[model samples]
Target: MASSRLYLSAKSAAALDAELMSSGGFSLDQLMELAGLSCAQAVYKSHPPESKRNVLIIAGPGNNGGDGLVAARHLKLFGYDPVVYYPKRPNKDIYNRLFTQLSNLKVSFTDDVNKAITETDQILDAIFGFSFQPPIRDPFVQVIRLLESTEKPVISVDIPSSWNVDSGPPKSGELGAAFMPDVLVSLTAPKPAAKFFKGRHFLGGRFVSKEIAKKWGFSLPDYPGVDQIVELPADNEKL
Candidate 1:
Protein backbone atom coordinates (compact mmCIF):
# COMPACT_ATOMS: atom_id res chain seq x y z
CA MET A 1 0.00 0.00 0.00
CA ALA A 2 1.16 3.47 -0.82
CA SER A 3 1.31 5.43 2.44
CA SER A 4 0.08 9.01 2.70
CA ARG A 5 2.21 9.55 5.81
CA LEU A 6 5.49 11.45 5.61
CA TYR A 7 8.84 9.65 5.99
CA LEU A 8 11.35 11.91 7.74
CA SER A 9 14.93 12.39 6.62
CA ALA A 10 17.68 12.18 9.23
CA LYS A 11 18.02 15.96 9.34
CA SER A 12 14.28 16.45 9.60
CA ALA A 13 14.08 13.79 12.25
CA ALA A 14 16.62 15.64 14.38
CA ALA A 15 14.81 18.93 13.88
CA LEU A 16 11.49 17.38 14.84
CA ASP A 17 13.05 15.95 17.99
CA ALA A 18 14.44 19.36 18.95
CA GLU A 19 11.10 21.00 18.23
CA LEU A 20 9.36 18.47 20.44
CA MET A 21 11.55 19.28 23.38
CA SER A 22 11.64 23.04 22.84
CA SER A 23 8.24 24.25 21.67
CA GLY A 24 6.36 20.98 22.16
CA GLY A 25 7.36 20.98 25.87
CA PHE A 26 8.17 17.26 26.02
CA SER A 27 10.99 16.08 28.22
CA LEU A 28 13.47 13.50 27.02
CA ASP A 29 12.32 11.01 29.60
CA GLN A 30 8.66 11.59 28.77
CA LEU A 31 9.23 11.01 25.05
CA MET A 32 11.42 8.01 25.68
CA GLU A 33 8.78 6.45 27.89
CA LEU A 34 6.12 6.83 25.23
CA ALA A 35 8.43 5.67 22.44
CA GLY A 36 9.52 2.65 24.38
CA LEU A 37 6.00 1.73 25.40
CA SER A 38 4.90 1.90 21.81
CA CYS A 39 7.82 -0.30 20.84
CA ALA A 40 6.85 -2.87 23.45
CA GLN A 41 3.25 -2.78 22.25
CA ALA A 42 4.42 -3.30 18.69
CA VAL A 43 6.51 -6.24 19.79
CA TYR A 44 3.59 -7.73 21.64
CA LYS A 45 1.38 -7.33 18.61
CA SER A 46 3.91 -9.08 16.39
CA HIS A 47 5.63 -11.48 18.79
CA PRO A 48 3.58 -12.01 21.89
CA PRO A 49 4.93 -12.99 25.30
CA GLU A 50 3.36 -16.45 25.06
CA SER A 51 5.75 -17.39 22.29
CA LYS A 52 8.61 -14.94 22.58
CA ARG A 53 8.93 -14.70 26.30
CA ASN A 54 12.62 -14.04 26.71
CA VAL A 55 13.67 -10.87 24.91
CA LEU A 56 17.32 -9.86 24.63
CA ILE A 57 17.49 -6.12 24.23
CA ILE A 58 20.71 -4.80 22.65
CA ALA A 59 21.12 -1.20 23.77
CA GLY A 60 23.82 1.31 22.89
CA PRO A 61 25.07 4.42 24.73
CA GLY A 62 22.73 7.05 23.35
CA ASN A 63 19.06 8.00 23.44
CA ASN A 64 18.34 4.95 21.34
CA GLY A 65 19.67 2.89 24.19
CA GLY A 66 17.50 4.92 26.55
CA ASP A 67 14.50 3.86 24.48
CA GLY A 68 15.60 0.23 24.81
CA LEU A 69 15.89 0.61 28.56
CA VAL A 70 12.36 1.98 28.74
CA ALA A 71 11.07 -0.78 26.47
CA ALA A 72 12.68 -3.45 28.63
CA ARG A 73 10.87 -2.17 31.69
CA HIS A 74 7.51 -2.05 29.89
CA LEU A 75 8.13 -5.49 28.43
CA LYS A 76 8.75 -6.81 31.90
CA LEU A 77 5.42 -5.35 33.02
CA PHE A 78 3.80 -7.05 30.04
CA GLY A 79 4.96 -10.46 31.35
CA TYR A 80 7.87 -10.90 29.00
CA ASP A 81 11.26 -11.70 30.52
CA PRO A 82 13.52 -8.87 29.36
CA VAL A 83 17.30 -9.09 29.61
CA VAL A 84 19.25 -5.97 28.67
CA TYR A 85 22.74 -5.99 27.22
CA TYR A 86 23.96 -2.43 27.40
CA PRO A 87 27.71 -2.53 26.89
CA LYS A 88 28.58 1.15 26.69
CA ARG A 89 26.35 2.79 29.22
CA PRO A 90 26.08 6.54 29.02
CA ASN A 91 26.93 8.57 32.15
CA LYS A 92 23.88 10.79 31.95
CA ASP A 93 21.36 11.50 34.71
CA ILE A 94 18.41 10.49 32.53
CA TYR A 95 20.03 7.23 31.48
CA ASN A 96 21.11 6.50 35.02
CA ARG A 97 17.58 7.02 36.28
CA LEU A 98 16.20 4.70 33.61
CA PHE A 99 18.74 2.04 34.61
CA THR A 100 17.76 2.46 38.22
CA GLN A 101 14.11 1.90 37.32
CA LEU A 102 14.93 -1.36 35.57
CA SER A 103 17.23 -2.38 38.38
CA ASN A 104 14.46 -1.73 40.86
CA LEU A 105 12.24 -4.05 38.83
CA LYS A 106 14.96 -6.71 39.13
CA VAL A 107 15.33 -7.03 35.37
CA SER A 108 18.36 -9.09 34.35
CA PHE A 109 21.39 -7.48 32.78
CA THR A 110 24.01 -9.53 30.96
CA ASP A 111 27.47 -8.83 29.60
CA ASP A 112 27.79 -12.00 27.58
CA VAL A 113 26.10 -11.20 24.28
CA ASN A 114 26.45 -14.72 22.85
CA LYS A 115 24.99 -16.34 25.93
CA ALA A 116 22.14 -13.84 26.06
CA ILE A 117 21.39 -14.33 22.39
CA THR A 118 21.36 -18.12 22.83
CA GLU A 119 18.99 -17.94 25.80
CA THR A 120 16.55 -15.43 24.35
CA ASP A 121 13.55 -16.22 22.13
CA GLN A 122 13.67 -12.86 20.34
CA ILE A 123 15.89 -9.79 20.05
CA LEU A 124 15.09 -6.09 20.28
CA ASP A 125 17.69 -4.11 18.31
CA ALA A 126 17.77 -0.71 19.97
CA ILE A 127 21.49 -0.30 19.51
CA PHE A 128 21.06 2.56 17.05
CA GLY A 129 18.54 5.09 15.76
CA PHE A 130 18.13 7.95 13.28
CA SER A 131 21.19 9.81 14.62
CA PHE A 132 23.62 6.96 13.92
CA GLN A 133 26.63 7.44 11.63
CA PRO A 134 28.51 4.75 9.68
CA PRO A 135 31.74 2.76 10.43
CA ILE A 136 30.75 0.28 13.11
CA ARG A 137 33.20 0.37 16.03
CA ASP A 138 34.49 -2.21 18.49
CA PRO A 139 32.17 -4.25 20.77
CA PHE A 140 29.18 -3.24 18.61
CA VAL A 141 30.92 -4.73 15.58
CA GLN A 142 30.73 -8.11 17.23
CA VAL A 143 27.20 -7.47 18.43
CA ILE A 144 25.96 -6.46 14.98
CA ARG A 145 27.77 -9.41 13.42
CA LEU A 146 26.01 -11.76 15.79
CA LEU A 147 22.67 -10.06 15.15
CA GLU A 148 23.29 -10.49 11.44
CA SER A 149 23.94 -14.22 11.87
CA THR A 150 21.33 -15.06 14.48
CA GLU A 151 18.30 -17.17 13.65
CA LYS A 152 16.03 -15.62 16.23
CA PRO A 153 13.57 -12.97 15.07
CA VAL A 154 14.87 -9.40 15.41
CA ILE A 155 12.79 -6.26 15.87
CA SER A 156 14.51 -2.93 15.22
CA VAL A 157 13.59 0.39 16.86
CA ASP A 158 13.34 3.50 14.67
CA ILE A 159 16.11 2.41 12.28
CA PRO A 160 18.24 -0.72 12.14
CA SER A 161 21.74 -0.57 13.59
CA SER A 162 24.58 0.15 11.12
CA TRP A 163 22.13 1.44 8.53
CA ASN A 164 22.31 5.02 7.32
CA VAL A 165 19.10 6.71 8.42
CA ASP A 166 18.56 8.39 5.06
CA SER A 167 20.35 5.95 2.77
CA GLY A 168 18.90 2.66 4.02
CA PRO A 169 21.16 -0.38 4.54
CA PRO A 170 24.86 -0.54 3.80
CA LYS A 171 26.20 -1.49 0.37
CA SER A 172 26.61 -5.28 0.01
CA GLY A 173 29.51 -7.11 1.74
CA GLU A 174 29.33 -4.89 4.85
CA LEU A 175 26.12 -6.48 6.11
CA GLY A 176 23.72 -8.99 4.54
CA ALA A 177 20.14 -10.25 4.75
CA ALA A 178 20.45 -11.59 8.28
CA PHE A 179 20.83 -8.03 9.51
CA MET A 180 17.37 -7.19 8.22
CA PRO A 181 14.87 -7.29 11.07
CA ASP A 182 11.68 -9.34 10.92
CA VAL A 183 9.81 -6.35 12.30
CA LEU A 184 10.43 -2.61 12.51
CA VAL A 185 8.86 -0.11 14.95
CA SER A 186 9.11 3.42 13.64
CA LEU A 187 8.79 6.07 16.36
CA THR A 188 7.09 9.46 15.84
CA ALA A 189 7.25 8.92 12.09
CA PRO A 190 8.96 6.50 9.75
CA LYS A 191 12.51 7.58 8.93
CA PRO A 192 13.78 7.56 5.35
CA ALA A 193 15.59 4.28 5.91
CA ALA A 194 12.19 2.70 6.53
CA LYS A 195 11.55 2.96 2.80
CA PHE A 196 13.96 0.04 2.29
CA PHE A 197 12.59 -2.06 5.11
CA LYS A 198 10.69 -5.19 4.06
CA GLY A 199 8.94 -6.55 7.11
CA ARG A 200 6.02 -6.01 9.45
CA HIS A 201 6.15 -2.23 9.96
CA PHE A 202 4.51 -0.43 12.89
CA LEU A 203 4.16 3.30 13.49
CA GLY A 204 4.54 4.10 17.15
CA GLY A 205 5.26 7.15 19.39
CA ARG A 206 1.59 8.21 19.20
CA PHE A 207 2.36 11.24 21.40
CA VAL A 208 2.78 13.51 18.38
CA SER A 209 0.24 16.33 18.62
CA LYS A 210 -1.87 17.67 15.75
CA GLU A 211 -0.05 21.00 15.74
CA ILE A 212 3.30 19.27 15.52
CA ALA A 213 2.09 17.03 12.69
CA LYS A 214 0.78 19.98 10.74
CA LYS A 215 3.90 21.98 11.40
CA TRP A 216 6.06 19.11 10.17
CA GLY A 217 3.82 18.57 7.14
CA PHE A 218 3.31 14.89 8.01
CA SER A 219 0.02 13.19 8.69
CA LEU A 220 -0.21 10.45 11.31
CA PRO A 221 -2.45 7.43 10.97
CA ASP A 222 -5.34 7.27 13.35
CA TYR A 223 -4.35 4.84 16.05
CA PRO A 224 -7.01 2.38 17.14
CA GLY A 225 -8.62 2.89 20.56
CA VAL A 226 -6.04 2.98 23.35
CA ASP A 227 -3.38 1.54 21.04
CA GLN A 228 0.22 2.75 21.33
CA ILE A 229 1.01 1.60 17.84
CA VAL A 230 -0.66 1.07 14.46
CA GLU A 231 0.54 -1.46 11.92
CA LEU A 232 1.40 -0.20 8.46
CA PRO A 233 1.10 -2.41 5.40
CA ALA A 234 4.29 -4.13 4.19
CA ASP A 235 4.40 -2.09 1.04
CA ASN A 236 7.40 0.30 1.17
CA GLU A 237 6.59 2.09 -2.05
CA LYS A 238 5.55 5.20 -0.14
CA LEU A 239 7.38 4.78 3.15
Candidate 2:
Protein backbone atom coordinates (compact mmCIF):
# COMPACT_ATOMS: atom_id res chain seq x y z
CA MET A 1 0.00 0.00 0.00
CA ALA A 2 1.12 3.57 -0.70
CA SER A 3 2.20 5.49 2.42
CA SER A 4 -0.27 8.12 3.64
CA ARG A 5 2.46 10.33 5.07
CA LEU A 6 3.77 13.38 3.22
CA TYR A 7 7.37 14.54 3.14
CA LEU A 8 7.69 18.24 2.45
CA SER A 9 10.06 19.94 0.08
CA ALA A 10 12.05 22.87 1.42
CA LYS A 11 9.94 25.38 -0.50
CA SER A 12 6.67 23.90 0.72
CA ALA A 13 7.97 23.81 4.28
CA ALA A 14 8.83 27.50 4.18
CA ALA A 15 5.48 28.34 2.62
CA LEU A 16 3.65 26.29 5.26
CA ASP A 17 5.51 28.06 8.05
CA ALA A 18 4.58 31.47 6.67
CA GLU A 19 0.98 30.40 6.27
CA LEU A 20 0.91 29.21 9.88
CA MET A 21 1.89 32.64 11.08
CA SER A 22 -0.36 34.52 8.70
CA SER A 23 -3.46 32.41 8.12
CA GLY A 24 -3.21 30.07 11.09
CA GLY A 25 -2.85 33.06 13.47
CA PHE A 26 0.25 31.68 15.19
CA SER A 27 3.40 33.53 16.14
CA LEU A 28 6.94 32.34 15.54
CA ASP A 29 7.54 32.20 19.27
CA GLN A 30 4.42 30.11 19.79
CA LEU A 31 5.45 27.62 17.13
CA MET A 32 9.02 27.40 18.34
CA GLU A 33 7.87 26.80 21.90
CA LEU A 34 5.63 23.94 20.79
CA ALA A 35 8.31 22.53 18.53
CA GLY A 36 10.92 22.65 21.26
CA LEU A 37 8.59 21.20 23.85
CA SER A 38 7.70 18.37 21.50
CA CYS A 39 11.36 17.71 20.87
CA ALA A 40 11.99 17.52 24.62
CA GLN A 41 9.08 15.15 25.09
CA ALA A 42 10.38 12.90 22.32
CA VAL A 43 13.80 12.78 23.97
CA TYR A 44 12.27 12.02 27.33
CA LYS A 45 10.24 9.18 25.89
CA SER A 46 13.11 7.60 23.95
CA HIS A 47 16.18 8.29 26.09
CA PRO A 48 14.62 9.35 29.42
CA PRO A 49 16.26 11.56 32.02
CA GLU A 50 17.11 8.54 34.16
CA SER A 51 19.40 7.15 31.48
CA LYS A 52 20.60 10.32 29.70
CA ARG A 53 20.51 13.01 32.31
CA ASN A 54 23.24 15.26 31.02
CA VAL A 55 22.50 16.58 27.50
CA LEU A 56 24.69 18.77 25.34
CA ILE A 57 22.74 20.98 22.91
CA ILE A 58 24.75 22.08 19.88
CA ALA A 59 22.98 25.18 18.56
CA GLY A 60 23.53 27.07 15.33
CA PRO A 61 22.77 30.70 14.39
CA GLY A 62 19.26 30.56 12.96
CA ASN A 63 15.73 29.67 13.98
CA ASN A 64 16.96 26.09 14.33
CA GLY A 65 19.26 27.36 17.07
CA GLY A 66 16.35 29.17 18.69
CA ASP A 67 14.52 25.86 18.71
CA GLY A 68 17.56 24.33 20.42
CA LEU A 69 17.57 27.06 23.06
CA VAL A 70 13.89 26.48 23.69
CA ALA A 71 14.41 22.71 23.86
CA ALA A 72 17.21 23.19 26.37
CA ARG A 73 14.88 25.07 28.70
CA HIS A 74 12.14 22.44 28.42
CA LEU A 75 14.61 19.56 28.89
CA LYS A 76 15.90 21.14 32.09
CA LEU A 77 12.35 21.48 33.38
CA PHE A 78 11.81 17.82 32.44
CA GLY A 79 14.56 16.78 34.92
CA TYR A 80 17.41 16.58 32.43
CA ASP A 81 20.60 18.55 33.02
CA PRO A 82 20.85 20.49 29.77
CA VAL A 83 23.86 22.56 28.75
CA VAL A 84 24.07 24.76 25.66
CA TYR A 85 26.94 25.38 23.28
CA TYR A 86 25.86 28.17 20.93
CA PRO A 87 28.71 29.11 18.64
CA LYS A 88 27.12 31.89 16.56
CA ARG A 89 24.55 33.71 18.62
CA PRO A 90 22.17 35.90 16.63
CA ASN A 91 21.55 39.48 17.82
CA LYS A 92 17.77 39.24 17.69
CA ASP A 93 15.39 40.10 20.50
CA ILE A 94 13.75 36.67 20.52
CA TYR A 95 17.13 34.97 20.78
CA ASN A 96 18.23 37.31 23.56
CA ARG A 97 15.06 36.52 25.47
CA LEU A 98 15.65 32.78 25.05
CA PHE A 99 19.22 33.20 26.26
CA THR A 100 17.98 35.08 29.33
CA GLN A 101 15.35 32.44 30.10
CA LEU A 102 17.93 29.64 29.96
CA SER A 103 20.32 31.71 32.10
CA ASN A 104 17.60 32.22 34.72
CA LEU A 105 17.14 28.45 34.79
CA LYS A 106 20.86 28.19 35.64
CA VAL A 107 21.59 26.34 32.43
CA SER A 108 25.30 26.53 31.68
CA PHE A 109 26.47 27.93 28.35
CA THR A 110 29.80 26.51 27.29
CA ASP A 111 32.50 27.99 25.07
CA ASP A 112 34.24 24.65 24.75
CA VAL A 113 32.26 22.22 22.61
CA ASN A 114 34.79 19.45 23.23
CA LYS A 115 34.50 19.69 26.98
CA ALA A 116 30.73 19.99 26.80
CA ILE A 117 30.42 16.90 24.60
CA THR A 118 32.71 14.89 26.88
CA GLU A 119 30.70 15.87 29.95
CA THR A 120 27.25 15.14 28.55
CA ASP A 121 25.47 11.78 28.24
CA GLN A 122 23.69 12.65 25.00
CA ILE A 123 23.67 15.37 22.31
CA LEU A 124 20.96 17.38 20.56
CA ASP A 125 21.95 18.46 17.05
CA ALA A 126 19.95 21.62 16.36
CA ILE A 127 22.51 23.29 14.21
CA PHE A 128 20.57 23.45 10.90
CA GLY A 129 17.15 23.12 9.40
CA PHE A 130 15.55 22.92 5.96
CA SER A 131 17.02 26.27 4.96
CA PHE A 132 20.65 25.22 5.28
CA GLN A 133 22.87 25.16 2.17
CA PRO A 134 26.17 23.56 1.23
CA PRO A 135 29.79 24.40 2.12
CA ILE A 136 29.89 23.99 5.90
CA ARG A 137 31.90 26.88 7.37
CA ASP A 138 34.24 27.51 10.29
CA PRO A 139 33.37 26.61 13.90
CA PHE A 140 30.52 24.36 12.63
CA VAL A 141 32.89 22.22 10.55
CA GLN A 142 34.76 21.37 13.73
CA VAL A 143 31.49 20.95 15.62
CA ILE A 144 30.01 18.55 13.04
CA ARG A 145 33.30 16.64 13.04
CA LEU A 146 33.07 16.25 16.79
CA LEU A 147 29.44 15.13 16.50
CA GLU A 148 30.55 12.58 13.94
CA SER A 149 33.18 11.19 16.29
CA THR A 150 31.14 11.04 19.50
CA GLU A 151 29.81 7.75 20.88
CA LYS A 152 26.86 9.23 22.74
CA PRO A 153 23.31 9.13 21.40
CA VAL A 154 22.42 12.09 19.16
CA ILE A 155 18.90 13.37 18.54
CA SER A 156 18.71 15.81 15.66
CA VAL A 157 16.01 18.45 15.40
CA ASP A 158 14.26 18.76 12.03
CA ILE A 159 16.87 17.98 9.41
CA PRO A 160 20.29 16.96 10.66
CA SER A 161 23.08 19.53 10.36
CA SER A 162 24.88 19.58 6.98
CA TRP A 163 22.29 17.26 5.47
CA ASN A 164 20.52 18.15 2.26
CA VAL A 165 16.90 18.66 3.26
CA ASP A 166 15.68 16.69 0.23
CA SER A 167 18.56 14.40 -0.72
CA GLY A 168 19.66 13.38 2.76
CA PRO A 169 23.34 13.11 3.71
CA PRO A 170 26.16 13.54 1.28
CA LYS A 171 26.40 10.53 -0.97
CA SER A 172 30.20 10.44 -0.76
CA GLY A 173 32.10 12.39 1.88
CA GLU A 174 33.88 12.24 5.21
CA LEU A 175 30.64 13.29 6.97
CA GLY A 176 28.93 10.05 6.09
CA ALA A 177 27.78 7.04 8.16
CA ALA A 178 29.49 8.05 11.40
CA PHE A 179 27.53 11.30 11.65
CA MET A 180 24.09 9.63 11.39
CA PRO A 181 21.89 10.40 14.39
CA ASP A 182 20.48 7.86 16.84
CA VAL A 183 17.13 9.68 16.93
CA LEU A 184 15.37 12.38 14.91
CA VAL A 185 12.52 14.68 15.99
CA SER A 186 11.05 16.18 12.85
CA LEU A 187 9.00 19.30 13.40
CA THR A 188 5.68 19.96 11.60
CA ALA A 189 6.40 17.19 9.13
CA PRO A 190 9.33 15.08 8.08
CA LYS A 191 11.49 16.49 5.34
CA PRO A 192 12.42 14.29 2.38
CA ALA A 193 15.85 13.82 3.97
CA ALA A 194 14.23 11.84 6.77
CA LYS A 195 13.81 8.88 4.39
CA PHE A 196 17.54 8.23 4.78
CA PHE A 197 17.67 8.51 8.56
CA LYS A 198 18.20 5.02 10.00
CA GLY A 199 17.28 5.76 13.61
CA ARG A 200 14.26 6.07 15.83
CA HIS A 201 12.19 8.74 14.05
CA PHE A 202 9.60 10.96 15.71
CA LEU A 203 7.09 13.63 14.68
CA GLY A 204 6.74 16.75 16.79
CA GLY A 205 5.33 20.29 16.29
CA ARG A 206 1.68 19.51 16.93
CA PHE A 207 0.26 22.92 15.99
CA VAL A 208 -0.79 22.13 12.45
CA SER A 209 -4.40 23.05 11.91
CA LYS A 210 -6.93 21.03 9.90
CA GLU A 211 -7.16 23.79 7.30
CA ILE A 212 -3.43 23.82 6.96
CA ALA A 213 -3.42 20.06 6.58
CA LYS A 214 -6.00 20.26 3.82
CA LYS A 215 -4.12 23.04 2.15
CA TRP A 216 -0.91 21.00 2.20
CA GLY A 217 -2.60 17.75 1.20
CA PHE A 218 -1.17 15.81 4.14
CA SER A 219 -2.70 14.11 7.16
CA LEU A 220 -1.00 13.77 10.55
CA PRO A 221 -1.21 10.67 12.67
CA ASP A 222 -3.45 10.83 15.71
CA TYR A 223 -1.33 11.70 18.73
CA PRO A 224 -2.02 9.77 21.94
CA GLY A 225 -3.84 11.77 24.63
CA VAL A 226 -1.81 14.82 25.76
CA ASP A 227 1.31 13.57 24.03
CA GLN A 228 3.50 16.06 22.19
CA ILE A 229 5.14 13.51 19.89
CA VAL A 230 4.57 10.22 18.13
CA GLU A 231 7.17 7.73 17.02
CA LEU A 232 7.37 7.03 13.27
CA PRO A 233 8.10 3.63 11.83
CA ALA A 234 11.46 3.24 10.08
CA ASP A 235 10.45 2.46 6.53
CA ASN A 236 12.73 4.24 4.09
CA GLU A 237 10.61 3.44 1.06
CA LYS A 238 7.42 4.67 2.66
CA LEU A 239 8.87 8.04 3.67
Best by lDDT: 1
lDDT of 2 by residue, 1-239 (tens): 23334888889899999999997899999988998898888889878999989999999999899999999999999999999999899899999999999999999999999999999999999999999987888899889899888899999999888899988887666564357999999999888898888989999856787778767867677788999898887873343
lDDT of each: 0.89, 0.87
Residue 129 local lDDT, model 2: 92
Candidate 1 lands at a TM-score of 0.95
Tell me how far the alpha carbon of residue 228 in candidate 1 is from the true structure, in angstroms, after superposition. 1.1
| Model 1 per-residue lDDT at 49 | 97
Off by over 4 Å in 1: 1-5, 176-178, 236-239
Score candidate 2 by TM-score against the native.
0.95
lDDT against true structure, model 1: 0.89
| Alpha-carbon TM-score of each model against the true structure | 0.95, 0.95
Q: Write the per-residue lDDT of candidate 1 for residues 38-105, one digit (tens) a residue.
A: 88998899889998899999999998999999999999999999999999998899999999999999
